[model samples]
Target chain A: MENKYHFACQLIREAGQFIKGRMTSDLDIEEKSGFGDLVTNMDRETQDFLIAGIKARYPDDAILAEENGVTHDIKDGRVWVLDPIDGTVNFIVLQDDFCIMMAYLEDGVGQFGLIYQVMADKLYSGGGQFAVVCNKEPLPVYQERQLAQSLFACNSRMYAQNTGGVRQLLDQCLGIRMYGGAGISMSKVLSGQLLGYFSRIQVWDYMAAKIMGEGLGYCLLTLDGQEPDFKTRQQVMFIPKAKLTEVLSYLKGVTI
Target chain B: MENKYHFACQLIREAGQFIKGRMTSDLDIEEKSGFGDLVTNMDRETQDFLIAGIKARYPDDAILAEENGVTHDIKDGRVWVLDPIDGTVNFIVLQDDFCIMMAYLEDGVGQFGLIYQVMADKLYSGGGQFAVVCNKEPLPVYQERQLAQSLFACNSRMYAQNTGGVRQLLDQCLGIRMYGGAGISMSKVLSGQLLGYFSRIQVWDYMAAKIMGEGLGYCLLTLDGQEPDFKTRQQVMFIPKAKLTEVLSYLKGVTI
Candidate 1:
């Protein structure tokens, strides 16, 4: 586990460096599903680099990555979920606020996680036996803040649709913020920069941050009341455990 | 003018440094107008420090600032508009994504501007005879992009109200972002990281970025078509010249 954790961190840093170097250059950007759902050449290249590094070390580990999807089923042994670049739109447009995320789950439990904010050069890594650290500093323990006293992040779609009383929830919270990426947004929550995040996210998006955040007393919930698995996308709330009931009451009618 | 520009830059950096140092310390946070609109002791201290510096260097200049409001009416020989800490909420909570902004106007015409992103250590300075420079590097000239090609920043209130067909406008654009502060959001637009910003803004909030942005061929407009003065809070759009007519079409019925 120790060796794997160190290897994951190293590979992520190298991938981050590679992505950082390409930011100023021309990107071969392509639309994945729609206009705003952007994918760039750097995304593919970075994912291949991380997957190659992982395969070389742990040949039998199943890899599920954003660009290429999963290599195999998550039945047993080790499964690595990767989002080579978490905020692809931000990467293509701003060259900032995006992250490289990877989570290592063994047989079904999360064992290790990493989210590297490339431009800022901040690496949030931990889980398994290690505590989450931002670069060299241990992330400060966050207080459990109430729903009304803290800022919340709700993606524009949720806010626009007023999904599950999102508009009402925003009115109750201190304010709303939109970061455009699950990795960076959840990172903000884990670091106590934000009170919590409410958005629809995939397994790759929430897995790494969930592991690190839960270790620090944060909570992750699927709004639909189904147990999260490595398969489906769901409306999830990553928040302080104390604010769970309060936030959920507002998001009651929200589904998917 | 050169001396004042250099002086403003020096004073802003000093204030930024002072504010940055105090971020990790205890903050006396208070709500100003509503729950989310916050003010802090640091905001007051930083404002006082900047005002004192300006008085020492340019004693006759009229100073209009956020914390203390205007020193006097703007029938000016020279006026300095200052926002000691532009994103007070962000400063109190996230401790990032806030800026110290100042714009120097001579006889009501923009003469100099400065916005220091304290945590990032980025100083965007220019105006009068100087072109905008980001930490000694001249900002790259941005091409005018169509509304469909850009991301926009809309305050939560505006988006929720669908004010001026904001919902329809958001649909046509690539995406919507909410940055909480006028300074950081406008800075993103001025730097090409965002397409434009639309929100109700006071004089000090838009003065600095407005000066710097206008010099770069960007345009500022009041959604109500009113000529902006230093006395009123108005709905404004800071965007590329090419996007004006197109964006205005969607916002036809919107009035602030």
Candidate 2:
């Protein structure tokens, strides 16, 4: 267990505690450039909190954030991609369904990724050879599953777009779910509650979960069946290794 | 408050406590007659628990339940509609998102309804002249809203079915969401987190919320633009009174 992993876990727990404490109050929320793309004072403060902590200890680490954009460098050095509150809409509007997200990338490799669903008392965390675990318990490995029996976690926008492939995929699966945050959906995929999750997601959205999921034999791939370039957001999916082909077939050739 | 409403709340709280205590263990779940319809031993026991309580107190009350069929004559008497576990799929397969549901109808009128989202400490409860409240706080009412500003809670099956009106509705709303359980969706609608919810649901599914929503100036109507018959399960929707016609235009004449 490296110190970085310990720091990642502790830092997220602290951030989560801060979020839980203040989220009950009336929050100041505003929409970002896109409709339904939301931001809030808590999100900004949480980002500042994480950045301040990282800068205090590992001052040279590069940062890529949803609210503040990129900082430092990514020419093969340590970088932390952070989205202080990943499900801001759920946070601002709904009673639940939000997460605090952060990922540690070393030399362009995802080392530690953490998604702390603040209210659930479970931190879905993984990095390096580390296995993803909820709270202190290692994630359970479910029985080998078929595509038809699995749930798909997706954003409403994708389903609402009325795309040909998405419409077909919605009909074929056990169900489609949207909990309003990438980290929340990824937690379901890692824990075997969902067979796969697809979304037009950004870098900070799937960074840590991608690192955590790999150890459980899960994969995050683009809809076009290419390995994802973390530098840019794309129509991406995370599916179990056993069911990749079946899930991919639903997304192939059909633009998301 | 009516004594029946108090009884409904207390009974549901106790049942919810029992469910929360036991839900984490491996469950014994089996499929019902319909595809994706599930029932667990907990469902049966909870049904028995509610029926026993009601029978002991109001012996002649007719009961309509998910696990057990109708009991006692229902020509014109008090009826208790109960779905011991309304979100059984979520209960048997996931970490959270299941509820204990019950509605008390007298002479074909919904008098009391309760939806207890067990793990989340939320009991969206009320009936008769009682107002709906979540965890003892009254639900908030928003100003007049339009389609573009509201989230529509819907099932993927509806979107997947590729019906003309549902597809168009899916594309038109500000966003769409499917939380996988009818109880969960109805809870969102009652609390104003969603503008509306559409589903092909059964009697016990939205009955309690329908009772509660009515007091809040909300209406639960069949897709065909008729007042719902409490006796039959239909393609139904719960929409705020202010947004009824707008949402109705999307559902009427749609194949879904």
Candidate 3:
């Protein structure tokens, strides 16, 4: 647990550079279960690189990653969650929504979070007393703005399922955005490009992002008004405090 | 009709730069008709800039733009259809997907197409024997690719209304992408990132994109298999030849 925050930051930067180096070259993308799910060769390579780095430095720590799944149990006291590349579709298409993500947890409690914009070389990292930093400059968690004034990042699949939620959210927000990557979408919220983001995403997708968001005083929670379990996937919404109150009240009236 | 292609390209670039310069500052965005429709101050400014530039160069030509509507007759031998900022939502939020689009119609037949990605400084322009060019480099029109190997772009709104069409299309394609902007989505087809893009978009949103897409050998038509009319908005779909054949056949079987 010692220096976990610093360790996460270093690991994220290294992983990001690994991804950046492989961007322009050909990628071997394969279908995972369905067409919507994809895994690239770079995903495997970066996961291996990140896991190896973490295991070598913290031999007793647990690890979780998109490719290989969880390697150990949380009882080990320290655990790392990783999404080597969040937007494989964007990467395959050579678009800009892709990102690298990492998070560290101590006894099941998130201790640090990091999400890096590989192309932009911008890293968002924070936990506890440390403020969220984008490329080393601290960024304040955006204060809750009016929904009509806030930009939102969402996934189409999730938005489709939560039509009522989506409509309600959009009715209040300035606009809706679909970038196709949860990590990148969450980073927008952290960086003020979006006031909030809601998606039906896995733990690995939101682990690192939630850590950074919480550190910046943003709210990341299940839409059902419960704490997100790190072991399972859920429909979650992350919003600034001002929107949180309004959104929560609105969601309460509508039974999902 | 004199130098119409060259004039369209020049006007698009100039309008693109004007929009790019305005992107640095905050935009004044307002709802147009519904929650999904949007407009901005830059949209108006870019339109004004385009109209002025076109009028100075070709006073007798007709003009059609998003904000100003039809400024002259369509029978003026040559007509210019302009979308000052094609992805105004993207422009207002991400400041990226927006583009300056212009298409020239000579006697109601598409003669030239130009779509400038302002932020990326990339332009797709072509007419007649001139090959599609991206930043002056000739871009290969989409190769004859099968649906199983090609990526497709369609918005959630369109997907909802045309579920059968979308499901059939998705069943045949490698994947579906929701980029949230018709112009930006269509650019992918011209650039080879997407094999095609199908969506219910306005004439202003697709006119210039459709012209550029045609130059790239991508077929732009209504979803029910008809030619798109310049006078009205339509549910359009642009597809590479092989996939277009496959999808059109599939659409024929599905009851819309």
Residue pairs in clash, model 3: A147-A172, A147-A173, A148-A172
Model 3: per-residue Cα lDDT over A81-108, one tens digit each = 8888898877776456688888888777
Q: List-wise, what DockQ does each model earn? A: 0.78, 0.54, 0.32
Candidate 2 Cα lDDT to native: 0.78
* Reference contact recovery of candidate 2: 0.51
lDDT-sorted candidate list, best first: 1, 2, 3
| Cα lDDT tens digits for candidate 1, A20-85 | 777788889888878678888899999998989989989978888888655555557789989999
Candidate 1 has an lDDT of: 0.83
Give the interface-residue alpha carbon RMSD of model 2.
2.1
Docking class of 1: medium
Rank ordering of all candidates by DockQ, starting from the highest: 1, 2, 3
> Which candidate number has the best DockQ?
1
lDDT of 1 by residue, B92-190 (tens): 778799999998887788887888988888899896689898898887666867667688998888888887677777788888889889988988887
**RMSD of each candidate relative to the true structure:** 1.7, 2.8, 3.3
lDDT of every predicted structure (CA atoms): 0.83, 0.78, 0.75
Count clashing pairs, candidate 2. 1
Instruction: Find the candidate with the highest TM-score and give its number.
Output: 1
Model 2: residues >4 Å from true position, as ranges? A20-31, A71-75, A160-170, A253-256, B18-29, B71-75, B141-143, B162-164, B167-172, B249-256
Quote model 2's TM-score: 0.91
- How close is every model to the real structure, measured as TM-score? 0.96, 0.91, 0.87
